[model samples]
Target: MSLRADLRVLWRSPGFRRLTWTRLLSQGGDGMFQVGIATAFFFDPTTATSPEQIAVGFAVLLAPFTLVGPFVGPLIDRWQRQRILLVGNLVRLVLAAGIITLVLADAPVWSLYATALLTLSVNRFLLAAMTAGLPQVVPAHQLLAANAVLPTLGTIAASVGGAIGGIATFVVPSVSDNSLAVTALICAGLAFGASSIAATRISRKELGPTHPLEKLDVGAQLRALTAELLEGERYLRARRTPWHALGVMSAQRLLYGLVFVASILASRSILADPDDAEAALGAFSIVLGFAAVGFGLAAVITPMLGDRVSRERWILICLGIGAVGQIVLATAPTAWALLTAAIIVSFAVQGGKIAVDTIVQRDTEDHVRGRAFTLYDMAYNVAFMSSAVVGGLILPDSGWSRPIMLGIAVVYVLVAIVFARTPHEVRPVPPRPVAN
Candidate 1:
């Protein structure tokens, strides 16, 4: 009954409906685009590429965030948020379609890098705009609920889209000839759909002033963004609690990447059969979807429990769960054992991520949030990228997978120690005046 009531309340909210629906379509498109591109890559005549090449392709797609991210956050503060979103979606539609064209034409692989970069850079910009706008649209009371639900939905989309994408590659033998083109068209269609829905439903009149595009002298804007991003740096340092929280979370990301290395390498070594490979990845994806939805729900519920306990306490507990799960995988002796461990790890890690998102959202301010979160995103990407770089050098048939997984567990524990020392309260409230 309570869930129904919550649903009714959510359903009745015009802003929530528009925001969720738009995000659903757009984010689904984002997920599908990821899937489609991977498929295209496999079919590209340049299949002889390096193992890290695929990683590089995806990394290039995400790398722009680090370069322009600091600026993006401030831009979110300066512009009318919806307009920024509108422009981003439209530009992406073109880029997605263009990528498809180049792929089908069998254009040089060098070309794909630029397309990926453009698509993701615009995505980062739009993502910043959306993050700043969400608080404005939802009732303050439901903010946490809203945040939890959307990411939940997005994660589910990612899992499903990945599955669908893999299947598309398997089933569509002819898809390779124009796989990139097909990916582009589908992405464009999704973008167009999302744009139409948002344009019709979003309340343009309600938008608050942000730094307008014309005033965004790119150079000066970059400087201002740097300043704003720095504002939070002092806050991060002064309040050891939040810094501790960020540290654990950052370490979690690093270990999380390591865990992936452990799993992929384990699977290849232990169950290298062609038939088992697909089954393994598929099983992981399906379980991940379930895990994603569970975590998403937990995130919404977490805020309800927010007043009762410290975020650090929650993170500490979750990290411990995660560390144990990591150990389980590292030491698992068989494929089934590894699968069991993977499921538990997925549950723990995904749940922890949900809480982290909520923590960051609640802790940070809108004005500097884009820069802050973008840096947050950068830290996340960098950790994983660094792990991959290490893997290429250190990875060998001799199997260092267990050692790596154990290392991840150690990183998590060390991070938790730092978090445990952090004070219980650190949500940046303004300084109060002394009573005279």
Candidate 2:
């Protein structure tokens, strides 16, 4: 089906539309929240002067939740997902308020980090629930198109949200950190409000594990969760298509993370003033806007491309293109080059991601889908942390290193070759009997 037809089908499905709105708002809020942080840490010379500081900021934001989310994935499968969506958004709303308080008070960095950690931890569950719940809103045949359209739209929403937040820094009359924090608070409120309202539109049981849940003592519950996680791992090992797709996606994300950190450093030190927060933020936002254009184009093209070639082949091609983007960054290392590279890499990443998501959702059983997505999220966040660690060690204080960028480009090319060679046949796994 063409993209337009798929969109028309989706438009007619009220359930899917509600879910999409929920996702779009929350993701956009995420983008705005992140922009606020980027402005504070990367653009503000007082807070973030060196790559070490930059790396540490990310570590603090990501590390704790990364450790906690995998263990919590099974709960998403066990509980009603609609409730998770509703409650999770509320929790984030409360946490966002706390973050605003801390920022306004100029509280200790640890306090701000802790509050942000809780907000993000809840976000992990919300995202897992959203992805897992997708199969419920759309039919089996529409799943591919839904996956391509929904997530791509969500990415664009987020990019727009971030851009809006960036513009707020200039419009608010005061370019202080407090003004950014206020902008973030408003975005968070809008996000939580829209998502919560949308979540209520779906019946509580609509997005389900139609499988029965077992009543167990606390110890038994722990054991069951552990066993279920193991089962998910084994399930992935047995399915060649999803396993290979996930490996390739994970590798790409890891390399992309490296590029991401490099871009931040480059924006702060090379493209704009290291000491001027607003100038630096403006420059970075322009780069982000260019990348958003790429994301929008990818959305339009990926579905059309997927129709012509096998998803695996398309993924391979995206990886190859991504390597070229990295090479551009390595050789040129100018503002325009960075912007151009962002556009190319953004296109490649979104295309590959759409393919990977479809592969995972199509191959996995609904009962375990939440856990599967959680694993995917874990891989995604861990790779991001790895890049931060590597960036901290290797990137110069200026955040510009031709060698590091070139090395990442080489890795991308090699991974693409390996991904192309990997077998992608669908191997069905026998369903294990569920204990009543």
Per-residue CA lDDT of model 1 for 78-196, tens digit only, reads 66777776767887887877877776788897897788676777766766566657666666566555555666665666555555555555565463566634743564457546764
Tell me how far the alpha carbon of residue 138 in candidate 2 is from the true structure, in angstroms, after superposition.
1.8
> On residues 362-385, what C-alpha lDDT tens digit does candidate 2 reach at each position?
888888788788788888888888
Worst 10 residues of 2 by lDDT: 211-220
Which residue pairs clash within candidate 1?
73-370, 78-210, 78-211, 79-210, 79-211, 100-180, 100-181
RMSD of each: 4.9, 2.6
Best by lDDT: 2
Task: Rate residue 210 of model 1 by lDDT.
Answer: 38
| Candidate 1: segments with Cα more than 4 A from true spot | 1-9, 39-61, 139-141, 162-176, 179-184, 205-216, 239-242, 272-308, 393-400, 427-436
Leading candidate by TM-score:
2
User: Once model 2 is optimally superposed onto the true structure by TM-score, how far is the C-alpha of residue 429 displaced, in angstroms?
Assistant: 1.9
- Each model's lDDT comes to 0.60, 0.80
